[model samples]
Target: MGSTSPPATAKCSSDWFAHKKKNGRISRCPIWGDIGEKQNAVDFEHSFLRAMRASNIEKKDFILEFQLYLTHGSPANDWYIAAAAAASDWDAFAAAFWVKFPAPKVQVRMPMEYEWILTELRLDEAKLLEHHPDTNNYMWKCNEQANWKDFTNTIKAVKKQEIEEGVEHQKLLEKTKAEVAAVQKGLWECIPPMPETPSKALGHSLAGMGFADNSRGRYGRDQRGGYAGRGNYRGRGGGPGQRNSTPLTSEKVATLAWNVALLPHHPNTSEGLQAYWEQLAAWAGRWGREAVINHEKPVLLKPGMSPVASGECFNCGMRGHQGQFCEAMGDQTLGFREREWRVLCGHNLPHSSGHSAQVNNVLDDDFDTWLSGGLGKGEGSTD
Candidate 1:
């Protein structure tokens, strides 16, 4: 009201500046330029009130002195202009100023990863609230949940999730255990346990091989060789690990024990054993020089192995060769089992014995060439 005659501008009566003198600080209250880029109208208002309060300026007359707080073009100046026109009391003007440029609120740092938290982690605002963080980093949660102030009013909503996860994990473990048990039960049904006694196990194996129960004593040996005289098959091997030597498989151990038990009664057992070796030697001499030279084991044939690769000969009922390569029989294409299954299934699979199939077999010379390391089918070939 100091310049009412000129209507130039309003200023604080002399009393307003007295607070500075009383506090022994001569600097005026901070000038809010409302300068570049800090467009925070809200913060400007809070700062102005804070200074007024700190200075102990009586709130009733603070409005008249408010222009002292602002510089040109500041939101404070704008509020002061409006306030000067109609504000009857300082408190009334302050209330209006607050409505226009409220206090600076704590804003949420606009969250980026909330979608992943919401969808992938399956967390909602309620779940975030449940974590009950102590004194840091709720700006995101404040933004996500209603808003900072109303949120101050809304966000108990986690111990429950742990209980739910535990339940699910327990259920999965039960299902896995059930599946394993079912497979184990099937295996038990298919392969009964080996016989407990050595003799009984040998007898069972011989029976499976179509030998009579007493025939275990009759096979593999008849005396007359030095081997039968030695009578002890298990010797102390040179290595410590092999000291108590036993055959690798339980079945072989059972068979040897059965034969050993009958050793006293079968003085002629070595004769059969010697004859068996002679026949094996003759077979190797005729058809498998590799066994003589390299001491290679005989071919191992398993069920469902390729018949061609295994050299299974239906004509001679032998596995070391295909019928085409069998010295004992003529060439054939379809193996006996293949032919049988095909006929049983009523399929018109062509027989391998036909001229076309026979033509496919390499000559014996070609097989010999292949064995000498030249490339060929390396299998069943005719003379």
Candidate 2:
């Protein structure tokens, strides 16, 4: 900004100007430090020299008028500069003045978008300047010294950094949107069917029933995935021909079939099963029921007795078993329901998809009033 106050010294006599009027008067600006605006020292010096040429001012004249040019608050009024001014040598005084005040620096401003970022950085301005480009210029102590050159470069780098980070933020926003969309689609699926849109056919990218893949990836004890009920897979999975894990030759099959056909049926219980085995051993039939059971004495386990008694090997159908000598049972195992099937059929039948599911159904669906020992069914039941 230019100075508001006019110079104390009036313009010099116009004899020189009148002489130049024959050639036209020289155009001029106010004396730089007096009436002229103080933008920079360079412009000040130029205007000073031009004013000197226009006035035929002697070498000593500037030193004399220099005091009139300076305001009361000017740096030239300092003790050192004032002492130099007392000397009549204009050159020495100018040199001393120049030393006290270096040339004014150019101004630079940061972009508005990064103004907040710069302000935040200045919260710890020391840290912000730690990675400065002009640290080697130790002569300059602050940004005012570096002004538009090194300082400007540093801000440019910061703007580039902000732009790069903004791109990453955009990418993260897109990822978050996709995740939110997926959650919305899943919540929409939980809503009940509407008459207008009977099925939410957004497509089955997710793993569930009624999806595009028709994939029932989710399965648990709820029978969500089609599976044989408990104690199931007995007839067909991982067994000899079917549920009969021990492979029998045609001769063993023939021998076992005839004898099993003549055997008496037994109720499906611990006591009934034990009695049926004892009864088979004493049948007095020419056909052998089981070679091991027939040859060895039958073990009669009374009710409430320990099942760990020395007797038949459930795993190998052998007596007084030595595990190394006895054959291992194949994959199939007989639980309570499987034993009932065996007792009724005489032999394990191969599972066929065409056959109906029988006794082994959902819990309590197959059992009825026959036992009726549960909550309200029995005599001890609460009314």
Clashes of each: 10, 2
Clashes of 2: 2
lDDT of 2 by residue, 260-283 (tens): 444444555876756654543343
Locate the minimum summed-lDDT window of 10 residues in model 1: 233-242
Q: For each candidate in turn, give its C-alpha RMSD to the true structure in angstroms.
A: 28.9, 31.6
How well is each residue in 1-383 modelled by candidate 1, as lDDT tens digits?
Answer: 23212112322644445544455433344344343544565665566677667656577757765776567676567767867788898778867866765555776654666765567866555664553222232223343454334565552333678778989999999888678656755654676554688565433322212112121112233342112211211111000011122223555444433432332221225654454334444434344433321111222111232221111233332233222222331222333433332221111111121111122222333444456564345554533
Assess every candidate by TM-score.
Answer: 0.22, 0.19
Best by TM-score: 1
The models' CA-based lDDT, in order, is 0.40, 0.40
Stretches > 4 Å off in candidate 2: 1-38, 72-84, 106-383
